[model samples]
Target: MAFQSIKHFALELDGPDDIVYSSGEMVTGVVILELTREIKVRSLRVLGRGVAIAHWLENRSVGVNTVYNDYTSKTIYFRKRQHLIRDNGDLTVIPAGRHEYPFSFQLPEETLVTSFEGKHGSIRYWVKVKLHRPWATVKKIKKEFTVIEPIDINTPSLLAPQAGTKDKMARIWYRNCGQVSITAKIDRKGYTPGEVIPVFAEFDNSTSRSVVPKAYITQTQTFIARGTMKQKRAVVATLCGDIVGPRRRETWHGRAIKIPPVGPSILQCRIIKVEYMLRVCVDVPGTSKLSLELPLVMGTIPLHPFGSRTSSVSSQYSVNMEWLRMAIPEQPEPPPDYSSVVTEEEAAQNSTAVQPEEDLSGVLQPSLLAYIQEFRSRPPPVYSEVDPNPQPITMRRRCMTC
Candidate 1:
């Protein structure tokens, strides 16, 4: 075996485990070095870098031959370098046993994208330490950390309710069958993981074929390279209602779709973007689906306190950023495309609960009276629903560890 003097070379971050760094946050860490003998060092340096990059290859058949083209683009958000040991012409000898070099960096005050690993692109932040010796090879160690740029959901714009309506006409053999229309609304557009999103929607089917009403949370990832762009979408969570007979109507009164653990929306990046959409759809038997999409922004912080919650229910839930560290145990493949087909395994995991109807006619229920007693601490959510003719909807949630 070859001789080596260094026993350990690692970078350790400070703060609580699974702590997510944010903009304008202080990042403190230590570079540890353990050596068995005296080591001569020219200079030791630390570098912090964050960037978004996209690269993909496409094939084109030129007559009988296939040609491959490469597309690449990169945007640097921040770069910082500091010398732990300054060099001055001559080599600096470092007598080694175990050395710990402490370092601190202040993230930029400007907006920074959250840490993400996508299909064709990614936004990443990391700290790298390099050791330079007179005659020995340069030793490099890298450690990646999660950065979740704070987006408060309590802002006026994100707090205002969002609603939309869409209509589609069905056709068969160049003949008009009928029309299907759907209206969907949400209390707000911003939310954090573990919070519940009350989806209020109405579906009307005038068509001859039966239609099923469904709602889902979808994630869209966009990557741009050399002016060319690639996009991938996946359904992260979903809930379904009973079928609406032809020429019938179905309504969703504050249906709950809990936002699963996921990375925040990444919009400040140049080459990559992560966006979410809540879609309420009607599946037509033989034609395209009629869908209504509402934009959604996931955040790192919850709304106001747990008392005055007319829009969000779980105001007690704080930031859950574990997906950042647990998401990518290794390189991640792109999420699957959005599909309505529920396999047996997925159906087995469906949550079907009968929610109690709210006393919207100014009647205070016993549950609210009990909930108001303790304002200091918030209780866990009662997986509930509403309707006089209560139709329990089946919900399927797909969480992105990334």
Candidate 2:
């Protein structure tokens, strides 16, 4: 109804149905403009850009007085434009017919933050087309694309396994009430989404009260704005309530927690960060929770083949220059905070298989493995509260068909 002269404006990518790309890959697409009637236009252009945005409200209390403050930040990583009709003179008329404009762009080789849609933030790449007319308001169209950076588990740091042990003594005044100790280890520190993380836990509880042990995977996202940093955390997956009776020593040889297809670790990204932690928690009545956390790195690809990887540093200068050319007057914004990077339905299908292994059998006999396996397969424990803060508004993109 807004524009009678235009029929349908469609954008199509030259790839499979899913519009996904890796770092340094070329993105080629076409903008099809079907017009019902002849129209006049000043120029036509296509723009490609990537941006990270974070916005949230913080609450604080001071001496019975409560106050709320709003915080917002945005960062533009790259912005590039290609004019399809730059040289054409003024008042150019596009005849009524099917018209197609082809466009191509190469993503920077430097490691880019993975595409994510979070509760308070987002890292997104999009292609936009504009039909500029002197007699009418500008008509624009936008399409979103996904970008993933390859993560190799075969890297030396990730290849070496990780382990840690901790001991905590509960004290009341000067008297020791109880002591709890745990040893935890993982097969690998780096993993891809859908891989099962086997956590081997040994608990020694020397106390009067019973301790409930729980294991879960946590996702932490840190956003940096200017110099200040804000973080949001969520327990994406979990297994809990395996009782460790008083004065008992229990060993869990195989507790598998599947990694959802979420964004990989984003340490190199300046504004946004995505990191996972395998947590072992023991809840004690009338006492602080005792826990151990181990870092987990997620990537798009696993390092089975151990192929050589290309250097992203080669395009660092070009990326900086591109940012300068965009000339955004405001400060750069940090990446977004994701709420559910992987949907529940999607997560169910992409879980790691609970396969029996001979190597694991050596550590703990079939009895212990079966016990832990049954516990792990049970439904995940319910979380009383994910976060206390108000839910952030979910972002909605303008219709790409418009």
Candidate 3:
């Protein structure tokens, strides 16, 4: 009779315990076994096992009191079985008590990384020892471990500043680490009207963790439209808003904040050429408030000579004066004079009277007169010329008579 008892079991492995090892690595361990009586073992084996498991739950509620729920689970397993060898070329026997055996097995290199987040799968693995005998029961012992995958980070490139602007600014952030960089563009001099300027924001992530970021940016501009005597100024508007995240639903607040006019001297020039300045400001979490000023120049549409020369040089100034207000006042323009305006029906009738009628008389005159004259002049065949006998002469008879 043969009996076996587990004496000692110890597992030794390198690398992260929760991280799956690359397949090239060797899993080594020792198992000590004792025999109550003299035992004969036909074969001794060791097994290494890896398993991936995932679980999910979903619950939904609708209307006043309706509820729906679901639960799901998935699992995958990998197993390797190897025979344990002894130094000697003979069948090894456990005489009694303490006996130790060392074993090593190779794991598959193509195994996917297991994750505890349940995104990929909950990775679980185990190493086990087993003994096989021809006439005896198999004995087994097992131990378990896990693995984690790495994260990827990315950042954007820096951009140059616009022309004619003073306080040029740039933004950058990390895609994975949530790190942000707000850089002032030293090169951007200013902006011109109708010139689309591109502002860049960059992101970088050098760490192993992934992060999500929310950003808000706004730029305000004030420029003078050169006018004679007094220059008029107003805010040239540009609005932009965007959301950056691992996913799209995140919303960011952004606007070109129009700064209040500092002084009347800022818009004092009078010519087709005008000078102006722009201010840029940004608000973000974990960073100080950012603000900068940039200078710009623009060309304006010249005022009509006679139009600006009207009676009260100041009386005709309402339009130009209103144009000088930078905030873009919300007051509505005066309503149109409806007293002189005609209704749709009346307008349609007036349009009809203004159009000339078709001249069918010239087209029909000659054709009609000719048709009538031809019909009246056609003579009726005379009935008085009727003959009692009709002559019929043969060609041979006519030739003989001649």
Candidate 4:
């Protein structure tokens, strides 16, 4: 046979999960090879590359025939080439039963954007090995890895609370109808996966019909190429609130919503971007719904304890980031039992809002961890509700001034 000595060629990373490798860190791995006999090797090389590519075809109509136009764009973040083993004067043969060659490379410190993949386009980081020989064909193997640029949630802008107010009017037959208004706020603008977002909202309905209020978190991915753009949006999590009676008002006091497993925002990339939003909306009958949107930044590092941002930087580095990638619960929560519906007597008579308790914790969304292996051992996040402040009901007075 022409080639018989080469038995196995593979790359093995130091960590069990790819999520551990991030920017400004050395990605150390070993190249393993097995052979029955000694073989003369030209060179064994390793290549590390990070790139963002966007490609899609758009259908264009010309006269009667439709033509597909390809829209493609790519941005190269970095490229590194290194030699694991080369044919020097003395080192020519790789003797055999089983051999392991170690390699290490430090990722670029200049803002290496987090890795991401999408349908229209993808931003990826990978390591590949090429084996060259004088008498045999070249052999190659590649493996994708993750690079998470830690976005600390304790920053000034992300730590500040966010609030918004919006109102919409509904009309039937062009006649002037009542209006519905919503005011909503959250504790902060940034959070990692698995953390809870405290939602405080007030809904006032001046219309004749009862209105239902709902809230949901959404993720949006945008890819751009040569003045062309593609976008994908999805709802990540949803929660429903009690209805506001006609001409009545209802308020939500720190009612929290758990964030599902999702990737961090990719704002530094020029070719692609990942973003999130928290939307609170009211369903108005026979008319369009009025909604309020608050921008959110999903991050790798979680918020500081006790809702304080002063020590965020110090605290972020204190925790082991390895556990964060698989920290969240991706399982769908079981349906809640409605048997414990609260009665008027059981509800709080006070309307004042109280401070939310501290939660001691962050997950990789499916898309982010799809390539990473053997990391699903952790249990899902515990579901906790910061009971919303009860709305007090006052009885109507029937005294008439005669």
> Which candidate achieves the best lDDT against the true structure?
4
Candidates 2 and 3 compared: the better one by lDDT is 2
lDDT per prediction?
0.65, 0.61, 0.33, 0.66
lDDT of 1 by residue, 1-402 (tens): 112778888888886434556578778888898888767778988999988787777788999999998989998989988888878777776665999999988888788777776546677888899988876678899887767566777778888788899888777767888888898888888886656677777888888888888777776567788787665555656677788998899877666666555556777788877787888877664466677789998765567675535655223223234532342234222222243432223223332322232211111122222212221122221111211000101111111221
- Runs of candidate 1 exceeding 4 Å displacement: 1-3, 306-402
> In candidate 1, residue 104 scores what lDDT?
87
Residue-wise C-alpha lDDT for candidate 2, range 93-116, written one tens digit per residue: 888899999999888777666676
Candidate 4 local lDDT, 42-132, one digit each (tens): 8899999999887877687999999998889989988888888865754477776899989888888787877665656777888899988
After TM-score superposition, what is the CA distance of residue 372 in candidate 2 from its true location, in Å? 26
Predict model 1's lDDT versus the native.
Answer: 0.65
Better of 3 and 4 by lDDT: 4
lDDT of 3 by residue, 1-402 (tens): 444344443444443332233334567666676666556666777778765433333346686775644333334446787777433445566676767677777766553342221121234567877776656677777766433111110101111233221111222452233332232222233222222222222322222332332121111111111111211222223222343333122221111222221110112211111234443333323323333344432211111233332222122223332333432334322211111122233334444222222222211122222222222232221100000000000000001111
Would you list the rank order by lDDT, best first?
Answer: 4, 1, 2, 3
Could you tell me the C-alpha RMSD of candidate 1 in Å? 13.3
Q: For every model shown, what is its TM-score relative to the native structure?
A: 0.75, 0.71, 0.31, 0.75
Write the number of the candidate with greater lDDT, choosing between 2 and 4.
Answer: 4
